[model samples]
Structure formats: structure tokens, C-alpha cells
Target: MSEARPYGFEVVRLARLEARLVVYDWAWARDNAERVTENWRRRVAGQPALFDGPVLLACDCAIVGEVCRLSLFETTYARFLAYRDGGSPDGHVANAFAAIVPWSADGAVLLGRMGAHTANAGQIYFPCGTPDPGDVRGESVDFSGSAGRELLEETGLDLPEDAPEDWVCLRGEGQLAFLRPVRFSDAAATLIDRMETHAIREDEPELSGIVAVRSAADIDAAMPGFVRAYLASAFDAGARARRRRT
Candidate 1:
């Protein structure tokens, strides 16, 4: 596939999100235990920073009104990683994640490049991570909280507690990415400086650097389908609007 040619996905606008913990057996993980282990071993050998820990996977999802509700269950990261490279063996579950789409006041959106030690090394996308047990409050998973937590952990930047309620889900490649758009009053350059400073101070940073997307041209192959879809629509529209105002 061309760098970004195969990157195709559907975007769904959402005003709210609800994820509930579910009891379901993942037959793929169970059925392919040996394969998952071998794949994970090879990955770790190349990138020792990867961890095969607990992560939540989506069992079911339905968009009702402005809300995206998901039924999720815990699974090993190794299993999810295995399916990410190889097509889903069971065809029912997906590695659902939440991401914070950081937009600058000047209509620029920022994406992060993964560090070499990461599983997705060299890939560029919004700061995100799969839902885990900590994301679950009682029976419901707080995806918004998860998104904010990931952005902060990855960039050392704090999102406002009062970010807008708007949300979007990009569905493709057996993954459901719940994205919450958060705007920064600072310009994209300023945001990049702060993030780079944070990375320098950290002992082990997840991101190697940040790239700002100002238009569809800025969207590229390093991003997954979901990330590409969002930027192609949102950033392109934003650029058009800015031009019209000019």
C-alpha cells in the first residue's frame, strides 16, 4: 500500500460516551495463545520497552443519538498487539482507545511521533492509549478521563478541565478511536516547544517529537487510518474556513 493510500476510515461525531465493563471470553486470545506469545517475544526482543500488561478491548459498540456506548473487557496487551499486526482471529473484538486531538487557536492540530523504543515506533498520531482497569469507575469506563490522562502522560501538558463536550469516533482496521478535541490558546509552535522541553526533562519519553497539521497535506502515512481520516476532514475544513475569513 502507498504510504497513506490505504488509510481509510469512518468518522462519527459524538456528544457523549459511555463504556461499560462486560463479561465475555476472548476466544481469539484463548485460541491463539501460542502465537500471541511468540509475536510478543519477537517484539520485545526488538523493542524492550514494550510491556504485555492488562488492557481493555471493546466487545461491542453502538452509537445511539450523540453517545457512543461500548462494552469492554480486559485482555493482555500481547494479544491485542498480535491482532493489530495480524487480522483479528475472532473478528468480534477491537482494541478500543481514547485520544486527545490537540488543536491550536490558530487552526493547527498537533500530532506526536512515537519514540524508537515504542511498539509504534516512527508512527505519528494523536496522543492516546487503550483503556485499562484504571479507566473503569465501578462498571462504567471514563473515556474522557482516559484521553486526558494519556495526553498528559505522553506530553506533560495539561488539558483544561472544561474542554468542550464534542467528540468523534474514527472506526477502521478493527479499532475504534474515541477522539476528544481539545483546543490550546497557545500557538502550535509554542505547544511544540513545551512538549519538546517536557521530553528533554523526562528519563524516558514516549514521543520523539511533535508535528503540527495545518491542512490535508500535513496528514501523512505515519498516522493510522483513524488519525488520517480525522485530520483530512477537520484540518482541511479549518484551513478552508480560515481562507474564507481572509
Candidate 2:
């Protein structure tokens, strides 16, 4: 196996982001839909709670000096899933969106385990979802809104409406994780217990359980590749902070 490349991210704050559907790339979109159908037949053993709703998937991106300018437009949820499984005909499509990495003051990162009936069953990841039409205001993308809505829907932990520590975009393969931190005053155990109880009470819960990660080793094999990379970066940063304190 090849050596795993370290994930690189650009620190960008949530500001004016333009996300309007440009002219639909017909050929590209059709190819993406075909790929999605193929993959769904092979990978998905059963039906998932999916909708044919339209979403914006990145068609192009580039690092212009210090900024990463992305070109995104409308595509269906089916196409987005297909694009996620390396189905983009142009190979430029990316799963680009924001997520909330809830952290306690005591060095614990809270992650959620997907329920068996959900699309990402058994996978471990932070509370987040893909950006949809609900996240758009005029032409700008409201990543903070996307982050907060997803966190509330999944974990039921209502964060202060306007407090995100920092924003970073993790790029690898076909994924782009726009992650933001939501710090809590509660201890790890307390937060985990609360989240788990919330999940249990949910009618159609997305998460089956909550996992509290205090160290890198606590990140298990069930986590997706991008999630593991994020955890590794987070853990290393924590270690360096401890060294500074010492």
C-alpha cells in the first residue's frame, strides 16, 4: 500500500459564499446519474431514506493564490451520492459542505454512529449534512446555518446560534469537509450521556449511539477515511497544546 498522504486544509471563515446554479452541464449530470444508479445497485443492499431532491455539487475548484474558489451548481441527491462514490465524469465533483465537530473543554470530541437504516449505517462521523436549498439565501451559501441545522437535527444539542471557533476545509479524494468547532462547558461523559439520550428519544434517529473521543486511539475503524484524517489532525494539535502547557 502507498503511504497515506497527510490531509491539508485551508483555514477560511464563513463569509460571503456564492452558490447559484450556473447553466446545467447536461452531459456531465447525466453521466453522474448513471454512475449513481450503478453504484446504488452494487453497494446499497437495501433501500435507504433518500430523496430525489436537487442539491449543489461542486463542478470545479482551484487554489487561486491563498483562496480556494469553487464552482458549484444544482444536482439531485442521487447524483450527489454518485459523485461521492467517485462517479463524477469530470473527476472534479466534490462532497463539499460544513460540519460541526463538537468538543468539550476537556479534550473530548463527540462523534455519532449512524443508524442501520440510514445511508451511512454504522459509520462514525461528526454531526453534519450536505448543503441544500435551505442553506441558501439569495445566492450566498450559509454554512453556519447548514452546520447548526444539521447539528440540531442529529444530536439535538442546540448550540448558541452564532459561535463557531474556526473554519477549516479538509480536501482528500472526492471529499471536502468544511468543519467548524462548537465548544461546550460540559464534560465528555455528561455530553455523551445527553446526546445518547436524545438519540434514543428521536422518532427516526439518524444516529444509533454517540462516541466520545478523548484520544486518537479512540477513533475506531468504523470511521470513514476523511473522519479518521480529521481526528488525527485534531489529536496531534491537542498533544502539541499539552506540550506547550507542560
Candidate 3:
């Protein structure tokens, strides 16, 4: 078996989904690291004029099944003036606009390995249930509330009433934000099933599919590199906790 790679995130159980807690790793923040830092600097630089209309946002990436795997939460701010002005005096306005990286938790139920679409056309892997809506941008003063709203808009999956309130930060670039569910309830599962069925029937009616993975080998054979890394981290964490209990 191939060794698992280390990932800078953690997943905690929630009543209806697993909440992925992100450990910010500066080293992992590749390519766009400087851009993100510069963005923060500009925000701080313009704090006086930008504070009044600042908006907060949350976003997540999720994997679904018996052991739910999800990405970390991220928080970002969007300035209203950046939208209206179109540009900043310091040339940082582009980064200033739509600063609130919307929070969302997705349940990517792996339906086994199969050829599917990719940026590199013709290249394929086990495509999971409904690809994340990519990044649905939004602006709101209430990050949590706005996150919930965005989740509904993007996936049509409403979170359980007792879901966790805190946000988990993931390490990445593009000023993107994400959150993952800590647990999955029967109702949530049912909703997902319905959504998947609807999408398959309406979009790709001829395809055969299943929800989540049936075994470790299934996961191994199906998942893409990044997804595999995430699952390995989550499984390792779970195994360590279990060993501690015993």
C-alpha cells in the first residue's frame, strides 16, 4: 500500500455532519500565498474606510458516507465599496471586491470509479456525486447565516437545525473558503439521495451510481489524489482516536 500523505486539516463529528477543522499551514499555501497575504495587508491598510461595509463569508468542501470526510472552514471579507468603486486607490481593489469567501459544506458521495470530465479533457477518475458548485461568491455581514444561505442555493441541501456553529479554516489559495459537515443524519442522507437521483435523472439519466464507498479498496481505486489525501488524513485521525480509547 502507498503511504498516506500528511494534510493540514482535521475533521470533528457534528450531529448531522462532520465539521472539518483547518490547521493553517503557511507552507501549504502555494502559488496564491502571496496574493492572500497581500489581500490581508490591503484590508488592514484600508481598515479605516473599509470596516463599515465589510462582509463575512464561509465555505466548505465535503465527502459523505459512514465516516464523513469534509474540508475546513474559511472566512473572508468583502467590501461594499470595492463593488461600487470598481478599483482601489492602491491598486488592491480587485482583491478587495467580493472578499467574503462564501462558506459551504458539500457531501460528495463516491459512487465508485468511472471515467468523467476534467480540465484536461478526456482525463477521468471516479467522479463523485454532484461536483461542488465550484465557488459560489456572496457578501454578507453574518458569515454563518450567509453560509447556510449559500449552501441552500448551491446544493439545495439544508443543514440540520442542531448543526455546529463554528467555522473551520482550510489551507489553500484563490481567496476561496469552505466547510464540511461533521456527521450525516438519516434525513440529510435521504435529501442527498433525492438530490442525487434528481441530478442523475435530469442531467445524466443513463449513468449507474451508488452512494459513498463500499470499502477501502473502493476508495483507493476511485478517488483523485487530493481527495485521497484528505480521506487518508481523516482515517488516520479516526484510527488514532479509536486506539486512544482502547
Candidate 4:
């Protein structure tokens, strides 16, 4: 958790992302609802308030210069979960999550273990969440605000409004994760200790604990695939740089 090796990440930010609803896949949704409900009941004890929320599914993405142009459409949370859990094959619905890879000055990366009561219990990932209605500003998505809010809410750490940023997007299966790398002045141990304390002291905290990943070997099965993928590339770059320095 305490090392001085630099992560050397290029920070990215998403100033604005467009989002909107699409044509109803009534036939698919009708068939998918029952399975989604049952699966939800199994995975989540009791019921979380189900809403006809907008889930941003990526229909197409192309890099136009540095910006990624994503064709996104909206669907309900129920339908999104169905596609997420593989109960439905409808690629029409995609879940979009925004997160920041918090890197300590000492090169350690902090991750969070989700609390049991949460939907992704025991799963480890960077502090992030699904973009909700509040994230919608006018007709555009506020990715930076969402990432900043989630980081503060979960770990009690805040990145300045003017923090340097770069948008890094990753996709797998039917899901897309939009990530921003945020650097912290704190060392890894300090951040981990502070986050762990926050998780314990906060009321009904969403995170169970903080995990410090210093190397690719530190990544475990509990972490989401996207996290492991990102860390692997980062650590590999660090290793190569160190080798060259030596």
C-alpha cells in the first residue's frame, strides 16, 4: 500500500455525453421482465425500488479525434439487469457506469469491496455507480460530476472541480464503463486507512472495506474484469518504465 512508484496515467474527463431513450423493445422487455424480477430477487434480498429508469446502452462508438462518439439509448433498470445478468440477449439495453481510478502518489490503487446489502456485494471495483436522472444536465450526461460525486460519497475523498481529466472508455460483453483517472496527493496507506474508516463510520455504508492493489498479482477474482484489465495495463507500464530507468 506504500510505494513511490509512479502510475503515469493520462488523466481524462468526460465533459458531456449525450443520452436519450429509444424505441421500445416491447416483445423483448415483456419476456425479459419476469426473469429479471426473479433474478433480482435471488441476487438482492428484499427488493430495491424498481424504476423505469434510463440505462444507457451503447449502440455504436467511434473515436472522432480524441473524443469517443457513443450512440447510447435508455432502458429501465429491470431490463438493464436482465441483460447484465445474461437472462436476456437483447443488446438494445446497456448499463453505463462512471468511475475514477484513484491513484495515490505512492503508486498504489485503491478499490472498494461492495457491502452485502448492495447489488454488487463482495464485488470489488473503483468507486462508481450507474448514472441516474440527477446526472442528466439539460440533454447531456454529466460524467465528471458523476465520477466526482461517487468518489466523494464512497471514499470521503474529493477531486477538485478543475482536476485534469481524460476520458478512457472500456467495453466488454454488453456493458460499457467510462472511466477517469484521478490522482490524489495522499499516499496509498493514508487513502486506504481513511476510506476504511469512512466505510465503518458512515451510516449504512455501501462499501465493506478498501483494498490496496499495488501490482497485477494483487488483483483477485473478486474485482470486476474492467478493473483488472485497467490495472494490468497500468502496472505493466510502470514496470517497463522502471526497468528502463534502472
Q: Which one is best on TM-score?
A: 1
What do the candidate models score in CA lDDT, each in turn?
0.85, 0.72, 0.35, 0.70
**lDDT tens per residue, model 1, 1-246:** 012222577777887788999999888788888999899999999999898888999989998777788999988899899988797666699879899999987878888999999888999979998889999999999888899898999988899767896888888778888888888888888899999998999999999989988878877888878888888767655677889999
Model 2 residue pairs with clashes: none
Question: How do all the candidates rank in terms of lDDT, highest first?
Answer: 1, 2, 4, 3
Using lDDT as the yardstick, the better of models 1 and 4 is 1
Residue runs of model 2 more than 4 Å from their true location after superposition: 1-21, 24-26, 38-45, 62-68, 87-89
Q: Which sequence of candidate numbers ranks them by TM-score, best first?
A: 1, 2, 4, 3
Candidate 4 lDDT, tens digit per residue, 23-139? 344457687678877766665554353344665555565544456555555556666676677833765545667798898989888999988777688999899988766776666
Task: State every prediction's TM-score relative to the real structure.
Answer: 0.93, 0.84, 0.38, 0.82
- Screening candidate 1 with a backbone cut-off below 3 angstroms (N, C-alpha, C), the clashing residue pairs are none
Q: What TM-score should be assigned to candidate 4?
A: 0.82
For model 3, residues 129-185, the per-residue Cα lDDT tens digits are 211223323311233444555444433446577765543222222222223433435
**Model 2 worst lDDT run, 10 consecutive residues:** 1-10
Candidate 2 per-residue lDDT over residues 1-246, each given as its tens digit: 112344443333333333444445746557456677876665555755555677766766654443456666776777676666564446657778878899887878999998888778899989988788777777666776788889989988888655744665667667767778778888888888888888888888999888888888897899876777778777777798989999
For residue 53, what is the lDDT in candidate 2?
77
Per-prediction count of colliding residue pairs? 0, 0, 22, 9
